[model samples]
Target: MNYSRRHLLQGSLAAGGSLAAFGDQHLAEELERKLRGRRPLGIVFCVSDGMSQGVLSMSEAFSQQVRSQGTVWWNLMSSQKAVMGLMDTASSSSLVTDSAAASSAWSGGQRIPNGKINVDEQGREIESLGETLEKSHLRLGLVSSATITHATPAAFAATVPNRGQEESIAEQYLNRVDVLLGGGSRFFDPKVRKDHQNLFEIFEKQNYQVIRTRNELLHSKSEKLLGTFSPGYLPYELDRKHDEELMKKIPSLAEMTEAALSRFLSSGDPFLMQMEGARIDHAAHQNDIGAILHEQLAFDDAVAKVLTLTAHREDILVILTSDHGNANPGLNGTGSSYRETNRSFSKVAEITRSTENFLSQCQQELRHSKLDLAEFFTSTYGFAPSANELDALMERLSGREVVEWSQQHKNSVGLLGQIVGNVTGVGWTGICHTADPTQLTSTGPGANQFAGLIRNDSVRDRLLRLLPI
Candidate 1:
């Protein structure tokens, strides 16, 4: 990084002590001086769902250890090209918010109750940012590492009473979103839907080019595209990198972002696009440090791709943030020694699969030899437990015991998480969402409006103000 960039980041980090320390008057002065009378022709909002600041730090350390450079998100911070802020992610019903309500704040300019998407508690549907952009004749696209109809992306394009009504959300995307990419093939297939309606056929009837693999997505020429590479959520990045078949079938978050940008920009019309790294939340909920680290890295790479496309262009506005925090994971001192925490993350690269995937494989091997289970863990994670630890894990893996243990240990994915944490020194507070303020960063036109402390709903209002309509 350049000298000025380094100086700016150091100053920002010092000023960003905590959300409580950020005063409103300072923020008002900064916005007044920097954001007045600015307009952008297009907007790209990128979300790393459930990303806490601790996750970003862990990912940066891991990236520097393995890749010899920090992640692009940190690079943007160190380059002083991004404006940073903190967003309070609370729903109308509670201080802690789920993905649906958290993202609805950004999509609808208000915080609805948890589990509803762009629908108020009074049973009225609010206009989403996607609808507002479409009214101005700007193209809109939604991409995710999760199912396309999942809560985070669905909030932007669909209005539903409950997030579980994914089939209905899938139908709404047909006419509303120009570029819809990600998984959830089951929701669109006739055989899987309760009504037996083939949503993909309906999309094709309306002139959408459906893509099902990485190669197809790269080569498609359609202006309107619907790509589903997995039946459910895509595989974790660590697993995808290790598996040849998955790498061929599944598109990375960065690849989907690039493809959406290609199709949207081709129209030469002002566009609004939202891309999500939905699996980072999933990994955090599981307390799988390796999975979350790789997912964050993938999300960071996608952010880099967006910055590259909008480089030196004042007409485009890019916003990067997260819905809320999950698990509140962080690196903890093993023995009162905070130094060399990076060394613990270096072993994370040896972890080729998620805790859930590895445990499932071990369950399948129970039909054969129990020794196979121990060997698998030892070889894959480079950690062999003591006799007592192996005995406890074996008890959990037995017939009826396994089900009860799984229910109680959902966050750890059974004993796998504890075993992994014992090796990596990463820790988690719980398996659910926390009421932590998420970080927000912005650049390009109207970026200054996002500096300092802001509410989650303010993101929607600022972007809406920039629309041509």
Candidate 2:
């Protein structure tokens, strides 16, 4: 249904009966709007799990270099239609928040300590947004590039004292969430679960069409669907893009977003859907510039999909934001007059694997000679490391300490990220979450509520105010 602003306001007024009880017309209208809500048909909450401000700009530049075009997020921000804001994120216990605490603040309307999902610092279980929406008969869906039961997605629906309880988080979603997509088949596979409870069979019995692999997801016509594409978190976009097998098996974040949204749009019901680009945080934690940029670009593609799908639908609001910032990555000037900066930054496009994958490969090929290791590094990173850099990396990989300025960069992944960054012009602060606020961009009906600075803990109330619950 096409709902005009005037029409909704008129309905609100009608629902309030006569406005005479209020002395002022402005007060009456405000009260009417508050009672009726913005009442969007659905809200698409898109999260780039740990995207800092620098990541957004880097992704835009990266897209221009590789895709021959700018990112959807860059275009959206430049357009007058988007409402911009910054989210003040934090946990009750610390200034720098973890994913579980940050996401819990958004879903539970309060800040808890780090490492807990929707559970307060005092060990009380707060009702998650999914549970509250379920009670109101509104459907909820979750999509991510991380484990389906990972912190970001789990916080929306599950209340657990410890965020590591993937099995418990998986069980909590059985009846509450209407649609589930993303990785973590191990949590659902009876063969892998410690208790050996077949979640797939249980979901099938509940009328959910359980599926795995990209082909099944695209072809299946089920309204209620459960799809898990990997045993753990999905592979990094850079790695997946280079692997034909992964391309055939794992669906992109945009594809999963489309599948989840299509189900809710077809139902024509009031719903809340969270689509996350989860691995951006993982890449950031490892200080992987190439992986983080590719991940952010993938997320921007998903944003484009959402905007295109909802272009003509006035009742669907799309909110794009992040939970927190991680290892703030930025491009630094290189050579005289910074002329070499672009040349250096352009080299990031040549990276073929995530630093995590690079480390994994190194572990498997530990016995290789230094010359063989140099060749492997050159093949994977598209640039050869200096002899001293290679020696330090080898030492770090072999569990020997290499003196580093930041204590955080002493690990293999951190050392490798810096070595690659020396060629790519990118630099990382450290290998952990930052206390900085994250970017927020919103569009569609009810987008104005998210304008200006938003507190993480206030997000739940703001979302509920716009939605009819």
On lDDT, the candidate that comes out on top is 2
Stretches of candidate 2 exceeding 4 Å from the true structure: 1-26, 29-38, 367-371
Q: Compose the digit string of candidate 1's lDDT tens values, residues 89-150.
A: 89998899999998889989898999999999898999988787777677889999999999
lDDT of 1: 0.82
The lDDT for every candidate, in the order shown, is 0.82, 0.90
lDDT value, residue 1 of candidate 1: 45
Backbone clash total for model 1 is 0
- The best candidate in terms of TM-score: 2
Summing lDDT over every window of 10 consecutive residues in candidate 1, give the lowest-scoring window.
4-13
